[model samples]
Target: MTQTTPTTPVPPGALDGTGESSKGEATDNRARSRAAGPGRLLAIVLTGQLMAVLDVFIVNVAAPTLRADLHASGSGLQLVVAGYTISYAVLLITGARLGALIGHRQAFLAGLTVFTAASLACGLAPGTGALIAFRFIQGAGAAVMLPQVLSLIQRTFTGASRAQALGAYSAVLASGAAAGQVLGGVLVQADLFGTGWRPVFLVNVPIGLVLLILGPRWLGGAEERPESRAGGGAAGRSGALDLAGLLLLAAAVLLFTVPMVLGQEWGWPLWGWVMLGLSAVLAAVFAVYEARLAGRGGAPLISPRVAGAPGMPLAIARIVLAMAANAGFLFVMTLHVQGALGYGALRAGWTFAPTAVAFGLVGLNWRRIPARWQPVTVPSGFLLAAVSFAGVGLALRDGSDGGPWLFAALVGVGTGLSFAYSPVLTRTLATIRPQDAADASGVLVTSAQLGMLTGVAVFGAIFLGHGPGVDASADALWATCLALAGAALCGAIVGLVIRVGHLR
Candidate 1:
């Protein structure tokens, strides 16, 4: 038997099953400290991410059932859906930073524990209010847990291994959204044990419990203090929480996301616009304050170095664009099929499966494209997505079902989006220093969450605002598709202008 100890360094790729470096031989020292190895580590982290992202869309299909059983108010029903989104968005930046202070593994487990418990509460709640409250806690837990997935990948993988890791990460991120709808619909429709919509929330309980058990072992000893390095100042390496910045971030994110979440539901109330404006002001103030705090040698909530990293601004802009377009496409398609075509939840949910499958396939395999053509992949993806969305709009012009062509179009859209985003995310993190990866992950996740909300609000409004008629709905969906295509085109132009991977 081989000797192993806390101080013993593991060989690169030793625990990855093949006993060979993936693509490139480069390895991170931090990763070499792994007790359970990178393969298990990646599995653990992605499992957490799957659980978090799955809940994001799972409740959409179950809402009506839940409302009827609980006799929920309109706003309460919205909260059941949007409550998770709001808390998840508002707390992301803080969650990202939490891993830096506590050990990443500890933070991850703590958050997972919270999420699992909240999910149980949500499943068993006696009233809509309790479910809503539990959903917020669940979202808060997700917000805390999700960022660590990105950060752990950044810190633990290098070279070709890192690329593949990010690919799988991208697959999970995109596929989980559609998967949520499908799973939710199946669970609700099946009504196993005659539990109505409870199973949708309860399904996570067992999964979460399993993950919590495996996390502490495979995630290394994040609860234990990180070992000190050669010199001094190991403590400084683990940053502290800046409560002021945390509060400001929470306030800004809440103010913005709440309005975007509820505005259309409330018929675009005036107070929503007021909140939007206030959000902008608060965000600006937060920026100025954080910058000042960083200048003073204090631990800023968002480190200036991470935010101002080379090519970061443009990279973030592309993320926002990609996510917003993706969200808008999904939102519009769901509404178009269900609201107009009058499909049941399960049927409507199945409509999204093709997109999810195509995205996963492309996400996992996109790297197989020849090196010579790799540079054009992102722009090309954007272009494909743009054309696909345009085609969808044209097909829907007459207010009739687009037939099998609709599924093919969805496949194209998903493939295009996978190309547009997964590589960009990989390239963006690759450019940042590993030490700053946590902070960078925070910025990225926050941007993506906000973009999703923005997409649904802006694009949903365009589809919804047109009023209730077959012709009107068809025209509105067409317009919405055009807008989505336009957004993709803009991203394509940006990708062409700035090669994210090549940014120095």
Candidate 2:
């Protein structure tokens, strides 16, 4: 059998291949620069991601303090949280487009500047309204920067290094979720500088400043190669920003997101249902409109050919389902442990330590696992997660204390590696052309954000509606567990189907 070479040209020094010496020498120099500075580059980008993700869960621990300190009413408090999420979710795709239009490095720097400045504003806000507004700005800033993380990784790294970079992204996400809560609890308890919950927002200021100063120099010109800047490889080459598509898509996302964020808080009001229904209709319209634009040889927000790829739909579904389960379960568990079980914020946060540890370890070594095992690994991991979730529910019901939760957390760690993200992401993007990387990454992240929001809303509703009882918390935990189990089952089926059909 003859060996087949990759059609996508490997960047110079990307592989030890037969080639001209002068070109190889130039590529080698570029590769050396990348190797020497990649750590710093990765640091700046990953830190941005960590901060963005941290903001998502960090505020939960500070909510009561914010309410009291800012004189925030119940609705005001909801807005404080929801504002960040809504803006982040709605503008993520737009942000990705902006990165493609200008450059990832420029976009990232701009975003970081906005985020850091907004963070400072958040820390200093004297009222709930101001805080909410600042948080929204912060979210928009995060949206503008987060997509660049993946884009830069795609551009700057290749082969195993790229795989490792992706693994680190997954690890940071897992740790940030748990660490945000833990750090928030600790900071609130410390009340350092007599600032109460202000430290949480203020903390990003210094880090952001450091990154802002060093990011430009370290990231350098790697992100602005002529091909990337020209058309972003493939997707960006099409046409001007699809303003109409952007508007419709943004409206649809906002409509869908607002209800998910606020419906549980407002007891699922009629207007919320209306918004949800309208969102679906708008989504359909957006799809039709995008398809028309693509057919007309115009730039569409989502390329039909890309979205129609064999495993793309299932992969997206897996993302939404998995994120929904993870987000919803975490939300309910936080309430159950703190409210019903009388656990303090710090204690509640520590319960997830096992998950972070497991996730970190697996992420660090994910490349050791062969690519072919992905299909089997993912479904197996989901099944394992289902078992752990069931154990958590059972533990809650039996009043078996913390031991069971720890075991469950540990067992659930595999899911973070194989189920929560890495495998599915690798598979989904495996066949995508490099030019479309930004669009594809944006789609993936947006689906994840929506899944998380929906999980919080749908599962929050279930937990909130539980009537007073001796085991009300347990009942809620069980319900959340069942939902997670169902999600895991769906994910497993998708994986198995893909394997059986040889779709990958």
lDDT of each: 0.79, 0.74
Candidate 1 residue-wise lDDT at 122: 94
TM-score of model number 1: 0.90
- The prediction achieving the highest TM-score against the true structure is 1
Evaluated at residue 196, the lDDT of candidate 2 is 91
How does residue 373 of candidate 1 score in lDDT? 67
TM-score of each: 0.90, 0.89
For model 2, how does the per-residue alpha-carbon lDDT over 1-504 read when each residue is reduced to its tens digit?
111122334334332211221232335434744653777788889999999988998888788788889889988999998899999999999988887777778888999999999999999998998999999999999999998887776556555565677778777765677678778888887888889989989999999999988887888664553224434333355545788988999999999999889888887899999999999999999999988887887778776646864467767877787777777777887788777777765677777667666766676675566645543666666777777777677777754454756566545743543444665665455445445667877898899899989888887887778866438877877787777777777766765555545534
lDDT at 109, model 1:
89
Least well predicted 10-residue stretch by lDDT in candidate 2: 15-24
